[model samples]
Target: MRKILAALLLALFASTAAQAKWYEASSEHFVIYADDSEEDILRFAENLERYHSAMSLVTGRAIETPSPSNRVVIFVAGGKGDMRELTGSRWVGGFYVARAGASRAFVQTIRNKSGYPHFSTVILLHEYAHHFLISSARHSMPRWLGEGAAEFFAASSFDSEGGMQLGMPARHRANEISYAGIPPVEYLLDPKAFVESDREASGSFYGASWALFHMLIFDDARKGQLTSYWRLLNEGTDSLEAGKQAFGDLEQLDKDLKKYLKQKRMSLFRIGPDQLTTRPVTLRELPKGEAKMMDVRIVSQHGVTREEALDLVEEARKIAAKYPDDAGVQVALAEAEFDAGFNEAAIAAADRAIALDPSRPNAYVQKGYAQFSIAEEAEDKDAAYATAMETFSALNRLENDHPVPLIHYYRSFVERGAEPSETARHALERASQLAPFDKALAMNAAMMQAGEGKIALALVGLSPVANNPHGGELADTARLYVAQLEKAEEGTPWQPEEGEAKATGNEAKDPVAEGAAKKPTGS
Candidate 1:
């Protein structure tokens, strides 16, 4: 009787897995996973490309297409229930997560409860805006500006005739503005108020932020102040001071914002077909089995809890067993094992992935990271560092634009207690330039500059990060470096002791040994 019941359970499991078919679509900047119709997935990919182009034009930031291994992954669930099952969040309609050297968006094809169309696209674009801006710039803006900009851009509309409209007023946010009275402009500028606000206050904060940003972007007299304010803040000026400096008198600015929000109709930014990409989206359907593995991999990569990581690792092992020759399955197993803290097993699986498909860059990244992890704990670190450096070098040749390899290449020199050679220096500088808001890369670059006696430049580099209000360990580290630099400037002869300034954020913790293991989107 027990055997019969076990067999029945196995049969049920197989049947359930058979239903997990997913279609994949790709464009210049995105890779989408969906169980929807092929036509719909293709259209979604095209829309994403259009959105990317539109944002690039609006921000005057060039769009650098991520390598195939690093392309942003978008998972489209069939409904709210599926999304909840995938993300374990019932209330979250969509979210973007960046970790383990990859960025992904998880969303459902559901109508907005607030009566907006293309809800999934809106959320995806909002997240992409965060990703785009962070990748393009050296500093993170205040929460009010970041959230307001996201809301403003997410209110975009695309026409059937290929026209696009941006900067549309977010009606829901506008309503919230009316319901929850605006906070004082001075209070809104305070990063602490933005970060520590309760849920009710947060609603008002977002509303007020959106209203203020709308006025700044569209109001004729205030339009030019937005850029100036960002420049001031990026230079490490206090937010209140920056606001006052950029926008003249606070009282008049407040009055202008109030009057602007009261207007019945606000202007919108528009782009014609000629201004955006017109390429058709291409899609391919994965086999049912492959699709199932892809879903498991996505879940495994994003697991937050230890038990969850263990379960995902077990599930990934099963998939890897069934598809032993598949490079992707091996890579999935590697990531799951890494998440479970099985560094040796992860390295072995990554090797298998590379053996199966040497051309795939993700396996190389995983293998290098795994080796670096082991090296950090090992007695003979020199050999491991050399091996990791070789792997990263190969990856660099394969994907020249990727920041990970460059980061690791320079980091290996630092770990070995050696000054960066010109080549290493250039690699780190380029990596920082490519991923300016990546705290790990930025911190490493600043340290390298300090090592070279460029004290002033290092301080300038650390300033924007030190001023972040959502103070984490990275912010703390930045503050420490800033203090050290200030002391040096005052002829105090301060210098960071060896290994004293370890990278202290989620993406980096061990300075040279960890490299850029993860990249958080801060969304």
Candidate 2:
């Protein structure tokens, strides 16, 4: 799925100097955040609205559009470096993250120099396709099919004269297919291989999958097969079996795919006029001080060096001085102070933010984290722990799907020297489901389960990390836990030696620390 690709593609990056301003605009289904001018932001919003309409037609499902209060957030960075700073990946063109019933996208507005049409638009649409599909359908599909569908829709183009084209040849994908060769359909269908693949394999997989889907959709005889395959998958059939039934013969389907790839020219689909929409878009600019504060918050969200942290704090303070009553600015200041290790200052700023806007969850998260960090030094640590837990509890109620709040809620029980209740167990499980790639969170859940003598459940939680050949320290730790669980099952007396079952130290122990850490953006 595109969500999995987003997680794998993200990399850690140190923070940069804070941005000075950002522009904002909105449409019925989307909000645009940019460092560009208002005109450009509005144009992007219009294009996104059109794209949403087009995708709804293609999927045969009406868009499950967000309400006025919860539009998808689109962050259009000024350049490549800005995009990299926000997403933590140098090569990522853009990505979408679904969080707490909202979707957020981070992308660069750079044009491709190789004469490619709508390069940046394609990237955004690719990510949007994932968001739309996930929102409209609650079912699952194979990774190859999901990604192939995204790429297929992403290649769509709208001419200035209002012509619409779909299924255009993807040149880059073709190149990858030519050089790397096509992977077997079985390989692409295997969800495990798709998730753990290396860069080269991933490229080939994407290319081959796209080509396969392109052929199936456009080749008159195979068009219906795509829908059939998806239907079978939805009915709980195994992907391989679904493919066999849908395509009739796996060997013949593979040959057809190879034949399609070798064609020098392919037919493109024209979108009918009925599929297009001409909805009006709305635009608004953020206040100057608030815009500047947004820049500070974005910078603070990424990991930062001490120097960068101090610089961000200074920048945020300048904005706060002008907009002293702004809750967002105060929250920005709190985040920067926490990053710079000024725990008490962070707590005070967070308190101010809460006083200004009681409904904002990030402020509570920051305040709770700062309190938890200093609890050990407090004269009444128990009271401090209780207060911290209470703050996180409020945050969880405000945004139940947010993994950070749930993570802190579970960790609070551990910090308070009490056995985690069933509530804590459910909270960790939900957090893990929401953020499967977070090795630290997964480790914490597995450790807690093992501590409760649920060795089998713990091993189930650790299996993915343990089997990850490329996983570094996390993989090693997971493997160790798996071995311990297996030994215990064998009736061998085994106790974890010193440091054998130690925490990763990277767990989301504090909500502020969790927010500051590199997580998949929007997630």
Candidate 3:
């Protein structure tokens, strides 16, 4: 279970990183860091907030905001090329990760295209749409619909006068639409089948998705069909069956979609600032020292491989040498040190950071990580873990809703050879709630509940992973669990947190087995 929680965190959390001279803009939904003028970053943050509001209006769903620390963090690279280099994909304009403890997006100046003046913003928008939709609905959608809806909204616009266009024509998708054509309805419905079929033909997957979603949004005759299909899927119907039930005939629907794409002009849904209260965005330039280490911060946030960490920590150490007095730099050094497997060095750097700025949350997190890593090899494992738990507890006091603290709190017990107590189990569930987009964490929580015979809670927790639009082996696995549980008895078994837990000693020992460390911890 701790592996389920730690694997992702470790994969994304970095050891060393580079770049600097940054300004930060904070808003309701995002925190933007860029090496640009305050005005530019502010505008970027404002536009993102407006886009968030616009999505709420278009989808007719109320905003479900997260804790301030939990809001998505956006890093504006030096330019689009910079991000492309990081991702190692020339086709990628930008990218994002939505983790339980942290969510982040990265971009650079995007060149505009089509009628959309801000075409540069499309990548993050498309990705964010996926995050928002999945988080909001708490159910999976067909891959086609998920991507289609993201593209549809990604093509939208915000005029100088603050006017909003919800579903403008997706002219950016023209190349794909023309080359790949709309993927056949069957390919759209069955992701596995699509992958098994012609690769080149489905290259236009995103474009085809946009086309179909656009049609569904505007076609008067097909109005509400998408909703019907979504409802059916969530209600446990097979995707193709749901598609046929909602649209009647796939071949006929494909024909209609083909005809629909030929329209020289497509539908547009418009709204104005008067209809939505755009949240205010605040901006500030970072102090020179901290600004200089921002590249390190971004890379650390992006995560890296162990070998990669060895390369990065030197760069981080050099930056720290330049800004030895800076708390941010110290924190960066701590991350880099940890990433490079110098756990004691990381703990020391974290201590330096905390001494510099006691309020910094990540410093404590980094310290906790080093403590936990060190404890793994300690002869007095319980004593080492108890100290590690204190660091996370301090983080909890700093930001009670932070998913990392909640997760690690539960894990601290498990690591100590003791069963997690009622409070620890509840905290684990809450961590899943806070980071619903983190399907892995949710799955682990559900499995823990299932093991405890809390079938209903387990089912609820697993639902989102099963419905994840980016269908994968995990989604398929979760689907099996959901089906199996539903057939067993309708809420036939429920277990309390105290049910079978054998919480030992002082509670932070993770409730079992030091000798098992002689064995294996299967992730």
Best by lDDT: 3
Count: clashes, candidate 1: 0
Give lDDT for model 2.
0.65
Candidate 3 C-alpha RMSD relative to the actual structure: 8.1
| Residue 456 displacement in candidate 1 (angstroms) | 3.7
Q: Give per-residue CA lDDT, model 3, range 263-329, as digits (tens).
A: 8888888878887767788887788777766766766666666766777787788778888888988
- Candidate 1 per-residue C-alpha lDDT over 275-320 given as tens digits, one digit per residue, 9 for 90 to 100: 9965666787875446657656656544445556666677778778
Worst 10 residues of 3 by lDDT: 507-516
lDDT of 3: 0.72
What's the lDDT for all of these models? 0.69, 0.65, 0.72
Model 2 segments more than 4 A misplaced:
1-21, 26-31, 49-57, 60-72, 81-104, 110-117, 130-143, 158-167, 190-203, 223-248, 262-282, 305-311, 375-382, 393-407, 420-523
Could you say which candidate leads in TM-score? Answer: 3
Error of 3 at 334 (Å): 1.3
Q: Give the per-residue lDDT digits (tens) of candidate 2, residues 1-523.
A: 1111112212211121143346667677787766665666665676667667777766678643444423567766556665655545566655554443234566666332222345556777776776566546545446677678878877776654444677788765767887788877877766556544476666587678788888988898787998898899767576788888998877788788898877888987676656687577777666666676665665555346676676567766777888878887888788878777788998898889889988866787778778778885778867887887787778767766666667766776777677778987888877766655445566677777777777766766676555433345666777787777876653233345566755452323111011224432211
